[model samples]
Target: MKVIKKMSMTMALIAASATAAFASGQQAEEISYYEPGASIESIVVDAAGKGQVGNWGLGNEYEVQALLTKYGQPTTYLSQAFDMDGFDDDSILLASAMTYNELGLVKNSYDGGYSYGEGVSYIDMNDEGVAMLEDNLFTTAAFAAENPETVKAFIYASMKGWAYACENPEEAAEIVFNYGSSVSPEHQAYMAEQVKKLVETDTMGNMVRDYGKMDEAAMAQTLELAKTYIKLEDSVAASALEAMSLEDVMDASYWEMAMGSSGAFSPEKSEVSIQLKWLPQSQFMGYYVALDKGFYEEVGLSVNIIPGGGDIGETTAVYTGQVDFGVTWVSNLIAANAGGMGLLEVAQVYQRSGLVLVYKTN
Candidate 1:
């Protein structure tokens, strides 16, 4: 599947507000706000189209629009300029915050955070049933078909890495920090804690021990959401997207086979490289931990991790043979497959969605 460098940004006018919602001098323990499960209707309707919402425009823009429309609220999409400053000034009343990244920044005071304490609440996409799958393991169909053992080996090592990372987040964060993290050390540690939640938690807020096993229900939901949001300009591609099924984009056999074995697979390719979805951070700490812990080497593979965030995306890089495997969102793989790249997702790394609509309650 051919993937674009970035998703198209939806246009909207950003509304600015000078209202300060928090007193930074207050102790964190003295503050409290709405519980996390607060209804979307409560926040969106109250905003009344004046409190502008922001998204990073990776793919969660669709989820934001879907939520607003579901609640019978009309909103123009805000593509960028979301930060703690935006929240402090009330210029951005609502913004997309990933649990592993932005959410950590919003809650952490040591790393120049908002320090709003418990005065903020969020709408989780997973709970709303509008979540699309985030980070996943994928490769071109031809690559997997030609090198099944290598694929299995990679999956085995990768999942082992993930399991370890989830169990020992602090050490995993330290390992990633030593690998040259893109965020601060404190923020990286915070990310490691939050990322463990995504990796091991389910949509129902239940803890799941399966690290990289593909959840069938979640995958179907993601495919359905992708069909609704991933717009293709090419008529043929658009048609392909509508007609695509989970089978067309995923091959669970490799994940299954890898899980069945206790690190006993002999790889056809001893040396392989993977491209990540973004820069070096605890968000992708599993791979770094796997490399650091010698999990890849244990599986008879020498894995090279290529940091992402260049002009090319992980899907495009993997599709063009720039990398043997890649980490990307399920929606991105769907779009690429619609364009006929035939990329196959091997494993779903993140069990739950991390995208949350964060806003202040007072």
Candidate 2:
């Protein structure tokens, strides 16, 4: 049976070569392998055919699988955008690509960690990307202006998703695993339990139960922190930075909409859906819960979750009507706003950043 399989594969390769020749004037080729003491000419021909050098003996199923995995496709546009190495790593890149694709961008060759330019810092391009994002901020501003209530609902849903993940790590893990199958089931379960412990012990525990609620105080703290890191120039007032206090950013009217009150902000009357850009982790839960539990439907929303990574282009996503909401550090957002992206803070998810740069401690 094994011999038959090998013969069949060889025949298929020959047929493929013949077809290529017929279509594009290429030559037919064959792969050869040798045992110990084989002729040098035999070895050279074999190496050229397989696009490799030296003797690798016979091809196995593993080699075939590797070819399928490696040379299977091309890189995508979003893949080029997030430029994962420029941000963090492959995981972040995959997450970002998934988010943007979900939010309705043209699909391209997207594998997780494709590096484009070497030593191009994400922080340095902040001005260029943010300038583009600033132009797109008008879309978000218009949405906020027209459907303030739905915006609040979207925030409530986001906060609720975070709180749910904290309260039920197992559930969150299941959700994340559904989208990201790369994580082992055992690891997913372990992560869920750990996240639960982290949230329960934190000062924000109470807020998790209340829809991952962010109050004016929390928003104020976030804005203050943004002011510390963001280099805002003369065009945006230092007071504009200060005015970003929780009171200016948070409008609860949207939550009222989800509750079906007369005061609810209705985008249907205006015919619009909010575009939300999600951090890979945040969207994982939101999608699993919203799809599984129907949270989005309950609120009368058609939420479009945009994935981000590589040159993730968060500013571009927001400024171009790709996403109305995005998960970003205050530093990034403040930079975007300063670059004139007009990105406003609707809520703050993480009080302390999970981001850390680690090297060998020793």
Model number with the top lDDT: 1
Error of 1 at 298 (Å): 1.1
What is the C-alpha lDDT profile of model 2 across 1-362, one tens digit per residue? Answer: 44765785677667767686543321222212234454333433333344332111111011122222233322111222323332232112111212122111112223332323232111111111111111011134556676576665565555556666766767877877766454355445554554343233323334233332334443444455455434445755565765554434444444434434432334443223333333334334544555456555555666655555445656567667766655544445655555556655554444322211110000
Q: Write the per-residue lDDT of candidate 1 for residues 138-157, one digit (tens) a residue.
A: 99999999999999999988
Give the CA lDDT, 0 to 100, for residue 88 in model 1. Answer: 54
Over 4 Å off in model 2, which ranges?
A: 1-139, 180-208, 232-279, 282-284, 356-362
Residue 355 deviation, candidate 2, in Å? 3.9
lDDT of 2 at 116: 32
| Candidate 1: pairs in clash | 1-336, 1-341, 1-342
Query: Over all chains combined, what TM-score does candidate 2 have?
Result: 0.49
